[model samples]
Target: MKRVFNKFLIQPKIVLSIFLLTSLIVLISALLEYNQSKKEINKLMENQSHTLLDAILISSNDAIKSYNLIKSEINQRLLNNAIFIKYLYENNLLTNSKLTQIAKENELFRINVFSKNGSRLFSSHPLSKFEQTFQNKSKEILKEIFNGEVDTLQIGIKESQLSNSYRYVVAVAAKDRSAIVINIDANKLVELRKESGFGPLLKKFTQNKNIIYLIFQNENGIIAASGNFKDLDDLNSSSFLQKSFNEEKFYSRIFETDSISVFESVNALIINNSKLGIIRLGLSTEPLDQIAQKIINRTIIQSIFLLVFGVITFSFLFIRQNYDSLSKKFRSIETYFKNIFDNVSDSIILFSNKLNIEAVNNSALELFNSKDKYELELNFNSFFVDLIKIDFTILEKEISINDQTKFLLISKTIFNDEAISNKFIFVIKDITHQKIIEKQNIRNQQLSALSDLSSSVAHEIRNPLNAIATITQQIGKDFTVNENENEFKQLTKIVYKEVKRINSIIESFLKFARPLPINTESFSLKEFFMQLKLQYQNIFNEKNILFNIQLNKDTQVKWDKFQIKQVFINLIENSIDAVNNNGTISVFAHEIDNKIEIKFSDTGKGIQEDILDKIFNIYFTTKNNGNGLGLSIVQKIINEHNGLINVTSKINNGTTFTLILPKVVEVKNV
Candidate 1:
């Protein structure tokens, strides 16, 4: 029973098919839900916009009517006062000064008495020029008043074109062939409209953060505004606002400014059968956008949950329905294959004719460090491209994955059976440890031969070099020459210098060939960097070069401190030589993957690409005075410590050297 259940559970094709179907259904459902949600949100926003616009329009109409009523009361009061004052003046109870006093008390701007014969009788205006203009305009109004045979008082309101202010005029005929006129200031009406009409309403609506602005405009330009009044001109000139006004209906539009998005709703402010102006209310659509995003997010999350649940439910039902008949037939076949596959040490992979991975055994999964066959199939092309390109029956190569190098021996065989024809079976065996041992053995043999040769050559050449140097120096000292023999003395001096140079070269070669002892000690990397900085500070200062060091933390690393210091010293000196004045050098240290990584980067003349590979070879120096053993010895020491050294350089840009060493060194006595 367990075997049959396992066979049903392990069929990847069935699980995959069910997962794909569920995902398709979930995706379609999620898309439909998202579309429906978007439509609902849009409808809600549109309705809100209409509702807001209607409220603003209603409030604005009331405000306008209130303003007009105030103006009418002011006009009637001024007219009645003018008529009473004329009656008093005609009865000799008031004089010009008294009339001026009355006008001042009433807050009237000007007072003029015009005769019925179209002549100015008296004026209280300080400016004679304005009084004359008023007199000229009053004559025409009096003619209309007398010719019409109207009632006691004639009142009218007019706007002053020069000052952009309103004036209330009242003319009263007193049956004495003369009329008295009073001019009342009407500018306060506009101020009252601004302060009480639109200000409070806009302030109330704009308390919400999303409301960007509210404005009321007429033919006379913006009469009232609220919220961000800095760019009123820009708002007025926007295409959205113009569209609203041109349509003269409740219209809403969205526009983008430099800083934010604005949604504007424009409604006509109509009162008493006239369109006064437009009341524009601007709101930020960010909240609406957030609503839509939340809907989408919820839909996606629900869809994912549904997909998972559906796949699981369907897969169980499918397995339960097909379990009985498949059990007997597949159990035997599965057991036979599972026994062979699990018992084998070598990894086995079966690929279809189209080069898609069909099956992988337990060993293959373990070899690739994968949880299942799917992971290996996904990474197979990148990890095994070299093996795939080879057309041999049996192949062997070294490859690296996740920083672990491995040597693989691969063998392929074709099967021509009816069900699995043109398919291939690959057997892969890991030989990494064995290959490392073999390479180490070969390296040891080469090093042994080189050490022997270097010892023999150094022993033979050092004695001759010393003897020659002594003889040349003795000749230079004993055979003191006059000016005529100066040439001979110079030649002896040159010979001595050459002999000393040859001896130095021999010493460097011996150092390269010999194995050095390593004293492994745990030391703080921070302290090590501090010592290096103190040692090289003077050199850096003299050259005007900046040196910087960065570290993740003060970590303890166990390694041969002397050898590693030597390696860095050589690299830093080389960098110093390569740089011009006022260059920069930086050192960085960090730990990753159980290894301590150190980097030395310099802004200096870089190495040529052609010779970069050969820099680690012995006696291959680009410098005129270089013995070329510095880097070669550095490489050898690093290899002995089981570390890696790499270099990258670009012409004129600079160079960087990276060294990776084991974080922990075993305490072993040599």
Candidate 2:
């Protein structure tokens, strides 16, 4: 019997018949079981959700009722008290109990008493005296109460994770001018009714079929009293809460691992105009598994009973059959080709030039610097810069790298009018270091050419400038003094003044052409500033402008003192030129965060916004008789020392010029 059954299992026709029959039975069983399980889960979830909605309605009604009663009690006491009544008519102190009594009765926190005349007479809580009552939104609601529009207004305080003291305010005003406010804890009802069955429910479902169940409240949609879901941190505190007050229903559909969660939302109407809350319940696949298990157990028992009869009927017919050897050979060939394609060192992306990756290798990930094949789909256009040797418009046929000619070979074999495989093989090689070196060489050459041109031109201009200055001085001395000669003297003075301007321009050219050589050594900035103060003391006194220097005593820098001094001198002169007679020029030097900063600021007319960008440009000026090369030269000197300069100015306010130089270690001259 065993041999007969073995032969029947090995036979092709008998095996095919058995497999098809088993598949058909399983499919029908699974479908019926799934539908029944789903229905049961949905019913259980909906019942629980409705219960949560009922809780919200009850809570809201309770809060509203509590608010109205508190307001009534406060008004009754105010109306009865002679002093309070008189105080409402006139200004006087009523007992603090007038506010405290209502606060205590309703389990309130604070009570504020506002007079009908808009004056805040007393408050149960000690608050800021100057707090603007009318400026706040709550005050508008309070105003309506004072006008006898509402018996009491109930207001819920917001939730803040940082604070535990939740609050609600109740306001009341009678025909009398006096008003009373009572505060209550807003979170009290929510805390009292939070159901804790959600955790166990989620665990049971997850164990059964890896599904999650969540519950939501109408008052707080995602505040599932019991569930494994994360908090509804996405809900806006004010607007989301207000949505419950406005909308009747909303739903959400979400997918989780091995399950789908359909959120069915409905208002929990406990009574007319009263809400308990919203409940969101989840149905999962756990019930489906239980039903399926039962079905499988039943099917197995039935299959065993039929196996005896079936084995006898089919056994003799299948005993003489032979197996095919071709199936094994084909499977082996398929696996061998697959292994070669997957293990190649370079990515063997054999696409039809339509650029779909048909075959990819394990090494393709490393070669393309990616972890997933999807990362490569964005095409060369996205990540080409990181891998390719050059950037040229894609449709260009041939590309050259470092003047080396490389042909982009496309396959000539045709499949329909397209190239055979329509495949183009292009390889990328790294040239980053070589490219960087080439750029540096080009920049150096350009700078060298500019320096040579500046030097030759400066020397040529200086010789002519000297001759012109000497002639102007000689011509001035040739004139004499008298009443008639006074007019001629003034004319020569004008010529000398203009000639002096030309000499200033030539001096700027010399400064730029021959930069001051740095004499780097340790220098005390504090001591340097003290010397500068002494030198400029008379100038400050004459102008009546305070000249102040603030230097850090501990600060020292290894720099060319003369060159840096020249830079400071130009900046200080510019500051002086900006300031009025009584204005101040402040110079500050300090070591800040490992950098040495020197700031020169003046309280004078600042640079205009339209011209600030031009201030650093060569040979640009805003001042009359100004050469404009001072700041340009200052920037050049700072750059040579590996420093940066910045200026901040507000027209009519003042201007500040800051020079930041990298701090250097001073070598001990032992």
Candidate 3:
């Protein structure tokens, strides 16, 4: 029984099992907390959106009241003034600027005097020369004003500039059949409506994140305000706006979009016995996603931390509780914990709930500049404060510690319930390394796919090009000299030149996709270039371009001699293409720090900046008659040799290509 008890107490598996169980419990608690918070936030947003819509309706009511008072004054003036009656009898309405001035002083956008029959006689806005109709749409307001059913009424007409915008008016009919109309600026009304919706305060709260508040008006929705304008235009549709126009009260709904979860609410606006509009407030789910990720991360970290602590505690107890009890069992337990520490992908750290750094493993030490685990003997929270110096509460969510993203997946649990309530475990994982590896893998995949396509395309094009070259050569040779023969010869020569260029393009593509086999042999750089200089001597002389070769004595590298020669030939040819009549091309090779370095520079019209990055990308060329594969093939050859190649160029100045190949360490066959 004692033996079995000791096995249970000292085993690493039991300790790790406890850690796993604790992680599961903490994760469950975090999930519950997150769900509860989300529900509460959603409810609050719904209430707020409804309140905003209600306010818009109230504003609309106040506008109607002001319209009615103006109409009553117009009716009284028509009955009292004989001159006004005469003016109305001769013309449909009066166009006196003094009357229009009175309305303009009140901040109205437009004012028009119309006859009882609705013909516009006066307008405050500049009327278009071709326009024959007025913008006012509320004929009901005009009918009531003329018939004395209502003293006055507000009418809105859609403006021509905006598809659904309304030009608001307060119309009053005079006793002489003349009508006075006051136009309210739609923009000003919208601004007042948005301000009344409690948006300014809500916007202040969400300035740091994404939130959108909307109001529905006359079967159309308007985004009164938004904290984030990522998808602001979505509110322009009539269907989305009209849905909440009939709702009597407020309600909330959640919608999932391509990237965000939107929490939405609808609330009605009723003012002065008229339903004006509805309001909706939306909160994006990005924050909730971040919160969920935080919880999961914390659970994983805490579980791993607890497992490590348990292993250490069990091992120490086994050593102290009579060394002979289970010495072999303790060793195995220690090794098991060591394997977990070494093999885990993310770096691991254990911090007590008080936020003290208790222990760190090898991975953590290497990442955080600690020589050993014992060197990490500082309060975790205090260490974070000293390093980053940000507010702890804000740092708790997203924190960067010493160039490493120390994502804290944290969990809290009481050990005995009284003195250690602050006790918690934290797991720190380095996501930077993982991201770097992922990026490299993606780049490799892209290059490989492009290379495979280039190979097939090159093969398909080169065979047809060879046939064209043969046909051109045959046509040139078989033609006899005569008046028509001269024209035929020139045609064949042009065809031959084009075919050769095509063949050159195909060869470069093949080189990029399938590198020539390397027959590695030690060769002196001085002798190799000497042969190249002699071979290309006549071509350089004919072009009148200076060809300079600089070589360091006894410089050697292991590479296929022919392949390296081809690399130089392609580079030199490009330099010639870029050069003016007397431009200079210089080639230099040397032994530098256990590697062979080669540089080819040209004093030619330099490459443009926009095309620099694309120089090595397949099918990217600046030359009209050029195949864009030269630099791509150069990069492929350098990569095959386990070397680095880079180019720099400046427009109208020069271009230089640098190649560095590592020294080969030979493995001798026995």
Off by over 4 Å in 2: 1-452, 458-508, 665-670
Candidate 1, residues 476-518, lDDT tens digits: the string is 8888666758899889999999899889878876876777788
Pairwise TM-score winner, candidates 1 and 2: 1
Which sections of candidate 1 miss by over 4 Å? 1-349, 360-390, 396-410, 426-448, 479-484, 526-554, 571-614, 623-625, 640-670
Kindly provide the TM-score of model 3 when superposed on the true structure, using C-alpha atoms.
0.28
The most accurate candidate by TM-score is 1
lDDT of each: 0.77, 0.57, 0.61
**How many pairs of residues in model 3 come into backbone collision?**
6
> Candidate 3, overall lDDT?
0.61
Q: What is the TM-score of each candidate against the true structure?
A: 0.40, 0.28, 0.28
What is the lDDT for 527 in model 3? 81
The alpha-carbon lDDT assigned to residue 442 of candidate 2 equals 45
